[model samples]
Target: MPRSPSLRLSVLPLLVSCLVASGALAREAGDTGLRLLHPFATPTPPGAPNGAAYIDITAGEEDVSLVGASSSVSEVVEIHDMSMEDGVMRMRRLERLDVAAGETLMMRPGGGEHLMLIGLEQSLQVGDRFPITLEFAERDSVTLEVQVREAGEEGQAAGQHGH
Candidate 1:
């Protein structure tokens, strides 16, 4: 059946509006509304080794970034992200990782961005925690105790935040 042009035009506007609204909703979900994700169990090494830290940091009411990281464990600490180039996976250093306001940024091995620990005095095992200092442009310096887990993730992404 042939449809009228005016009828299609009217529906077009509604469809466009619906798509725009949907995008906004997705962004809102990604953003921190009134709460934030707090970092937990941030593990680092003493000397130097190829390792990483997996944690979930709560974002404040304002947007921020996980700019840089440091620890007594490693001589060098850097915020890094894992990406693939030409199907080859590579770990790249980042100036900062964005944290949406009132949202949580998951720094895991197999997802998103994470901290890469280079050169370790000793390798980390499960049931271990160490001190990790975080530096955010907006937030002041915060020292946190990070727990180490087995190869795979072991802790639930937990934190507390309110407006």
Candidate 2:
């Protein structure tokens, strides 16, 4: 028998918190078959208009589409993709991102995909923590705590591309 979704969702935060308190580097959460892992954001300079966050998402028994997100740290949150087109870097907003069953969607700094925090309410300093809610299509949304780390710390590459 598998754990119930509600039960898992309820306990995930405590589990993740304990792990982090024990010196674990990453944070994670999930409900049903979808798991969110290693959510972190970069520190922002004073008066910066925007910031960015990255996370890795793993799909379990079913496919999941990440449709949107919200956070108190910013006025708006957007899903964005950065890629090279004709030798020029381009960033585009995405309506939704799909992760197939058993696949993982990895978001990182300086390239690929990320969450854009537009109209930042305040500068994100290192060690700052906040909540960001991720909405999935036809599934329950989950709010995960995001930790602020300096770029390049915790194995994440450092770059402010597309910011």
Per-residue CA lDDT of candidate 2, range 29-138, in tens?
45456778767899999999999998888888888899999999999999999999999988999999999999988888889999999999999999998888899996
Number of residue pairs clashing in candidate 2, backbone atoms closer than 3 angstroms, sequence gap of 3 or more or interchain: 0
TM-score between model 1 and native: 0.64
153: Cα error in model 1, Å = 4.6
Candidate 1: count of backbone clashes, pairs at least 3 residues apart or interchain: 21
Q: What are the models' TM-scores? A: 0.64, 0.78
- lDDT score for residue 113 of model 1: 78
Best by TM-score: 2
Q: What is the overall TM-score of model 2 with all chains considered together?
A: 0.78
lDDT of 2 at 6: 89
Question: Which parts of model 1 have CA positions greater than 4 angstroms off?
Answer: 1-48, 153-163
